[model samples]
Target: MRSSLHVLYLSLANLLITLSITLPSPVQTAGTVLVRRSDDGMWHPERYGGGAPKVNNPPSPGPALAASTIHPIPSPTLLEATGLIPFSAPLETTHPIPSSLPVEPKEPLRTIKEPEPHESPLISADKFNKAMTAANFPVPSSEQHVAFVASTKKAKITSALEAAMYLAHLLWESHGLQEVVERACVNSACPGSYISDLDVKGKRYFGRGYIQLTWAKNYLEASKGIYEDDRLLQHPEMVSENSTVSWETAAWYWGAKVHDAAASGNFGRTTAEINGPLECRGGWSGAEAARSRFRLFTTIAPIFGAPGPFLEAGCY
Candidate 1:
């Protein structure tokens, strides 16, 4: 009985050992454990604190260890069943968008042309006619004198007309028609002169051109300074026929220098004295003609767009 009891006790002990070896190891769901292989090729628990839990069956031959083992989680997608990430974040796109049509560049702006310098502003013809009539010009009842002057002296009728028109404009701007006529008659050898002895023979020393530019020195200087032609002094009649030359001489004579001098109270007498006896003989007495001529100048200055005071003071 003792022998039989000993055999049964040994069998019971062996059975307990076999059960412990065959049963699955207790695995904590929240913790991890590591198992190492023994010489017999069976896995046995080696680390229990913080290693991967032992698999129920020996892991099947997994893919060979990757050359680069570190990997980031894949982007979330509905197709990946094992993936547990939530809503997809916006993708950081880097690809450029393809365009189907080409864009045209804007055209450059065009520049506008400026108006011509010599062109006159729009003014009423009635105003011009009234002004001319007021100045006693009467708009040439016939073109006879204009034609004669043009033919006899090779002068231009158009030039004379332009000069006359320019003068009429001045007269309208300055004093009345009578004042203009009286002023123009000063020292003038025309049909009307305050003194008969001052009148010369056959249109000699007549107020020839616009501004009645007279005196040899004045002619020479004006021709040279304005027209840049020294020979213009010889053909004094050309001043009436040539609008270009006439206007230039007019500008120089009636412009800033004489204007400034007159404004300063000299009245252009001091400068006239420089021309010798023939130019300034009677002194203040002779100045009457000059003063009269200057009055006409003042009257006509407005036509050329000069101010009244400027004309009065000879300020060009």
Candidate 2:
């Protein structure tokens, strides 16, 4: 019985070995093997079947190809129009950026305000008259003397008064008392008629106004920064009508070297005393007129805080 059992076991083992050699293994069913085509267009399995899908015929290739390579095709026009192109790439450009271009920051809006107007410096007639009265001279009875004095040789009344007033103020500021100038005016020998003409040789010379700014050379020089013409010196009355011109001329005369001697001291005492001389020529009498004219300045000085001759005499 043991012998028969051994022979049966040997037969069973041989049958198992034959089945293993004929049928595919379990590993073959788990994976696939690739099949490649030959140049002749025939396909043959390169590896044993491992439960993979079957391919019937080899695919035809027109050109030689590299292993593991791919070729991309252009997108269809219809697909591009519909914005459905697959794997579309963006284009690259090479434009340069401008260096001066400013990047403005956005700001919220706001409101703004406007500016105001300006005013002038002219004084009123009442204030001027009052100022003159305060200086201590009797006001002229009529514009007559002022007018005659101004019109003496084509001199404008307004211009004469303005010049007279300007000189009076300057003199008053330079001198503490207006009486000194008044005394010079009443006593001086300078001709009144000649004082009206503005021409150098026309007779009227250095009539009214400060320093008796006489002579064509002196007038011309004084007028340099003051008036357009030195002829105004020939007719000193123009200084009154034209305030700007009058002030400029006054400043120049008072500050000049030629008049330095007479203009010395706070009251311009030297000039007043000189004008007081009776033997003087030309507008020497006008110096006395200037003294009278100074009365107006004396009256006005307090109101304007103008310095007396003493205070105004020193160089600034």
Candidate 3:
């Protein structure tokens, strides 16, 4: 009975050893990979499986994704067309996406304040009336006086001398601001065919405005400078018909061409600017007119309190 019992124990021990060698692990039988906790504290596929799951052991990394294989989200237009989003609705996102469109920088506009009615300076009404009386010019209406002051200011006639010189020219050309349009001869002897196109409309560019602005080209240029268009060319009579337009055109011409020469106190130089071909050259046909202009300048200068012994008036 003892020998039989001993034999059974020996046999039982041998059977246990064989079972342990031949039987598969629970995970292996389930066909699942053994997982270990990584440094990030997450469970991942283990390097090898035999003992308990590791705390920090991690598997080798897989192949990386290619740049070409990556895709971006559809454009707003495409998404709207496909009915993914309502038309004109703003796109929603987890993160605020930066705009790819270029932003244009805008320039700030400059503003100029308009002057008040009584804001006349340098060329005051009392002084102008005195000057007109002294020059034997016709007494201008109150409206005419105001218009003259405004026009001078627009021409940037800051000094008394500039005012006197400008007035002298206007007095000579416009006949003391009485005749806005030139008194041209009716016959073919008069200056009418300056620009053939202007004559087609019966628009004579002989002489008009305060400085007697002549020629179609001058009218066109002044129109562009003042109105920023060719309206003056089309309606040449506006230079004489519209007082504001007339005065502004003269002011534009003075500021652009004659102001600098007048500032030099050289009467003849200013004459040359107005009619160089006719009056400036020695022994020219309009030498008499040049002398007349000089006389007017000398006469008006003292009235406006301009300091003299001025330069002798001649083209040279």
Candidate 3: tens digits of C-alpha lDDT, residues 152-265: 877878888878888888888888888777776324425535665544266667688888788888988898988899988888888888888879998999988888887777
Model 1 lDDT tens row, 139-223: 5322322322333122121232233333432343223322212245444434543223423234333344444455555666766
How far does residue 316 in candidate 3 sit from its true spot (Å)?
A: 4.8
Per-candidate alpha-carbon RMSD to the true structure: 21.4, 22.9, 17.7
The collision pairs in model 3 are none
Per-residue CA lDDT of model 2 for 1-316, tens digit only, reads: 9999977876676445335433322222111333444555343443221223343332332223223211122224433444432322221212321222233567866656555554322333344455545655454333423332332222211222233334354445324222212233434524553342335554434333333444445556666655566556555445434544444554555444423343332333433433434322336565555455344544554554444442223211
Ranking by TM-score: 3, 1, 2
The C-alpha stretches of model 3 lying farther than 4 A from their native spots are 1-120, 185-192, 196-202, 282-285, 313-316
Regions of model 2 farther than 4 Å from truth: 1-129, 133-212, 225-244, 257-265, 268-301, 306-316
**Clash count list over all predictions:** 9, 27, 0
Ranking by lDDT, best first?
3, 1, 2
C-alpha lDDT of residue 154 in model 1 = 24
TM-score quality measure for candidate 1: 0.33
